[model samples]
Target: MTDGILVVGDISARAQAAVTGVVKALEKAFNAKDPIALSEQFALRTSWSNAMGTRLDDRRSIAESAAPAMEGFLCDSYARYDVVKLLEIAPNVIAVSVAQTPTDSSGNPIEGAWGATLYVISEQEEGWKIVAGQNTAVESSSA
Candidate 1:
């Protein structure tokens, strides 16, 4: 679906597949606990804001922090990433939102206001790379 965004227009099946692949790569990298490899998935000069508010503004910073930080929180957690929506904003750029639920090893939900991430991916000569991303907490509005 277009998510009611006229700018996205219509996407070809091939384009859709490529975008999906980028999402898959993200999950795979996280599951693998290889931060350096994960950073490679991003553009050389990228911006990433973690759910906890840590900001890595470039590939160098991302590679340095992502792995160490993730090791602590994700070591005993299991989460699945889902591509909630993909908006092709330009000829080679796509904005994506993903839904994820992190649970303990026993499948119990982790205590947190976290649920989704927003990403901007760009198609490079080799493949798609995330040029920017932000992980945020999902706060409830119900009182």
Candidate 2:
């Protein structure tokens, strides 16, 4: 393969990994209900925004945002994430389109899926950190 093509392939691979790893870490964090583990994956200055247009720009605020859903919920009942699309928007920026369907309280698939969550991932010295993101609820799911 040409040097240019080889370089492009490498870049793509790295992007893919960054996107995949970040998504997986999110999933693992929720699945395990391990906030500290989740915190480790994010940068100290991470910013998280909720579906309601609320934004949390600090670690304390981020934890506060995630605490509700994770609290009292069984780790086994968490949802799994599937990446619908992964795009390399910039040299170290990745956009991940992920679909997440919550299972019932008993850890079984719910009658219908909740919705998809879109995430913007950035490469940090520690790892992939979510500097900004937004989520939308899918109300028209046929299930």
Candidate 3:
């Protein structure tokens, strides 16, 4: 999906919807600050790098790292994720680009907290799961 529109291609509508659905699920989980729920969107062997560049090798590790932050320092942090682009690299595989804007609990945007995330998702027996992801903070231009 790009700009709230799915990029038209040879991919099936069902596939597009499913991939988009996964991204929505992630947003939901993040807002809820449920580490377990958040990790559910990923595959068992997922590779994830947080916006701070901390790399986690699997879902368990991801959840483990998220628990304290979600319950402590980042307890009040919220974010909204928009799918900026989706590319079908191969059959049943999609590369998703997401724009993440930090928001308050009331869903109001927080300045200077923007981020971008790239997710590599694939269809598996359990459904669409993110296999790999990298999140990077968007820095303001000095110019």
Report the lDDT tens digits of candidate 1 across residue range 18-109: 77777777777777777877788888878899888898899889888877767886665565566767777888788887777665555456
For each of the candidates, give the backbone clash count.
1, 0, 0
Q: Model 3 scores what on Cα lDDT?
A: 0.84
RMSD of each: 3.7, 5.5, 2.6
Candidate that would win on lDDT: 3
Residue 50's lDDT in candidate 3: 95
TM for candidate 2 is 0.74
Best by TM-score: 3
Tens digit per residue, CA lDDT, model 2, 37-78: 665655678666655668777666767666665675343457
Cα lDDT computed for each candidate against the true fold = 0.74, 0.65, 0.84
- Sequence-dependent TM-score of model 1: 0.80
Q: Residue 4 CA error for candidate 3 (Å)?
A: 3.3
TM-score for each predicted model, relative to the true structure: 0.80, 0.74, 0.90
Output candidate 1 Cα RMSD: 3.7
lDDT of 3 by residue, 43-107 (tens): 99999999878999999999999988899977888988877777888999899888888888988
**2 against 3, candidate with superior lDDT:** 3
